[model samples]
Target: MSARPRSKTRATWLTLLGGTFGLHRFWRHGLRDAWGWLHLLATLTGLAGLQRLDAFGIDDAQAAWMLPLGGLSFAAAMLATILTGLTPDERWDAQHNAGRSGGTPPSGWGAVLAVIAALLIGTTVLMSSIAFGLQRWFEAQAEADLQTPQRISVPR
Candidate 1:
């Protein structure tokens, strides 16, 4: 049996809203796919770890592991949404709409939405990452400065 045609617009929305949980993947590949489940698990675990760290005020070292998982998940979701929306209708139809009797699926501003989302989300994520790195670097530098002794010279 041939797969039914899926809407790129709807798929883009699902990826935007629940890509970390692999909702888009489930929509495309069904619930039995291990990749979808893996995405879900990783995102959930990362979020849980972050919550725990925040609640307990854990050390930065402890929080380090969680950030990668969360950041990776966020990047993947945004990128997937962008890619899905930007994909040409013909290619999308060939990959996902083939064999379906349904006429042309309406794309409905998919490219526009994708471009907007990519610019907004991508910029925010990139900025936040840079800020986080800067904060960590400053903190480390402050620690080092505090540890170093200041030199004093006696004047006649």
Candidate 2:
């Protein structure tokens, strides 16, 4: 690890802005972190899902399933941002900046702003994903009902 102290503010901002790509994880754990690679893979998958949706349109069956991967990945990243921002400075310094000369300086307003933004964005993404999935499911069910042949009853 480098002798430089890890700034909580920078970590919080990275989590907010690039957590889906695992930038925050890379910052904390260095390049070899497996989780960082996983984050990159998942983010790429999510982007592919978006491309599929754009190419096939929302009604496409594959797109319907694929789009949620992006939203969920984003929501999880926002949650991580919130958690990182909310951690106490002392604890953050001890855990991430240990052996550094001065330890991490106070995060101040930057961490607070990151937490607020993450909460707003995360909640919106999560709710929208749920609503979109449910709407698609119901539409599919309705379409199926309409396509099915109805049975006629005769007087017995």
Candidate 3:
């Protein structure tokens, strides 16, 4: 096997920061998408909508938060794809590989995985804290109820 030629120095960091603008997409393999960038923009901006959705009986807070987070990750991935270029199919020989390859594709999916793991851990911490607070509240209520007993009188 021949040595892999180096593409331009990794611009992934730029792609990551400028994902909302889709700057990464342009440099990776000469690709572009305005709508996907729009989605990223929406994910970045529509965070308030997620909270209001809760008032409309969408009580699944985790899902509510996660959807937007996942959307952001998806947008980031799109940006990453734009920035990283799609993976090269492995059928070509050295010359074709040289033509087709665009440096090592930044692992957009891997980045998404890391984001998900961090979010999950954060969610768990928040949920446990809430649960602990609720448990304490109920315990306090039970104590109050025990201390304040109903009285009964003898009946004739």
Candidate 4:
């Protein structure tokens, strides 16, 4: 089978580099497949929760950096996919070619997954500690309140 000619209009290059900034969707296609568009919607919901949990210092009405991070990850994944399709040399020729690892990009998913797991475990432990402290504080306050009970109207 004949090979498709290399695109010279910079779509490939833009898609590869724009991945870092998450501009690939707009470069490859039109405005319809915008990367940050749908990403922002989902991030908004997460941002609400983020605020509730005080994850980030962002205001309740404002957007969070999570939206941009999501888009960037999308771009990274798609560009890596495209790179895996081409030969090592061909991929190197493409713009922003992250050195081909045996003709394939490293599976960054594992790293992301591991980091997520670590963060979850860490947060759980921290919350547990904080809850324990709060529980003790509440018990002490209740004891004090009982010891200093206000005199009520006994029998008229």
Candidate 2: TM-score?
0.88
Q: Which segments of candidate 4 are over 4 A away from where they belong?
A: 1-107
* Model 3 lDDT tens row, 1-156: 454643322343444455445555554434566655564565554444455555554444343444455355444444443434333323222323465434444344554543454445445544554564455467667878999978999999
Q: List the candidates ranked by lDDT, beginning with the highest.
A: 2, 1, 3, 4
lDDT of each: 0.76, 0.87, 0.47, 0.43
- Regions more than 4 Å wrong, model 1: 1-4, 58-60, 126-156
lDDT of 3 at 112: 52
Q: How close to the true structure is residue 62 of candidate 2, measured as C-alpha lDDT?
A: 71
Q: Pull out the clashing pairs in model 4.
A: none
What TM-score, computed on C-alpha atoms, does each candidate reach? 0.75, 0.88, 0.30, 0.29
Candidate 4 versus the native: TM-score? 0.29
Model 1 residue 29 distance off true place after TM-score fit, in angstroms: 0.9
Ranking by TM-score: 2, 1, 3, 4
Tens digits of per-residue lDDT, candidate 1, 78-142, equal 88888888888888888888788676666878656765876688667656645655665677789
lDDT measured at residue 98 in model 4 versus the true structure, 0 to 100: 34
Q: Which of candidates 3 and 4 reaches a greater lDDT?
A: 3
Candidate 4: Cα lDDT at 89: 38
RMSD of each: 3.9, 2.0, 11.2, 12.6
lDDT of 1 at 116: 80
Alpha-carbon shift of residue 109 in model 2 (angstroms): 0.8
